[model samples]
Target: MSIEAIGAIGAVEAVEPAALGVPAAPVAAPGFADWIAREVGQVDATLATSENDLRRLATGQVQNLHEVMIHMEEAKLSFQLLAQVRNRLLDAYQEVMRMQV
Candidate 1:
């Protein structure tokens, strides 16, 4: 249920004091592309762990069925959340394209 990847939502770029003739400082925080890559990597890892647990269950190596089910559910939810975010971003991009400039 934790969506730490969405923590990039409020990141702002560093601005320069152009009026004072000062150059802009480099941003220290990770960018949107990095965040997306990290989030996708997390989702992939979750899914892989769930798949491994399922395989272990099939091989009769898993003792707790509940824990395996929980992992599966976690993976499912993570993927769903990622999908929703992608859909929203796509919708926004399409809307922007349709706007008359």
Candidate 2:
């Protein structure tokens, strides 16, 4: 028997960068910017897919209600995690900005 507490953990790992005009990651030894960009791009992709699924469901194109709900919840958790990351980063940046030289 298997139980899924939060599906977002896996979903967060499933995004690939399509809009960046560059390879997804590690093809050229990814840097910090590359890593962050890839993460954001992937989360964005997940959110986009979730949104599309919602639209399809509303239009009766989706047959599995449970699957759609799972996807939506994953997207929600992913977004919340992303938001927390952003907040922490911003806080760190502000702290750095306030530091004395």
What lDDT score belongs to each candidate, Candidate 1 first? Answer: 0.94, 0.85
lDDT of 2 by residue, 1-101 (tens): 34564665676654557665666565566687888888888889889989999999999999998988998898889889889988999999999999999
The pairs that clash in candidate 1 are: none
RMSD of each candidate relative to the true structure: 17.9, 23.0
For residues 1-101, what per-residue lDDT tens digits would candidate 1 score against the true structure?
45765666557556559756887786789889999999999999999999999999999999999999999999999999999999999999999999998
Give per-model TM-scores.
0.73, 0.67
Best candidate according to TM-score: 1
Local lDDT at 96 for model 1 = 98
Q: Model 1 reaches what TM-score against the true structure?
A: 0.73
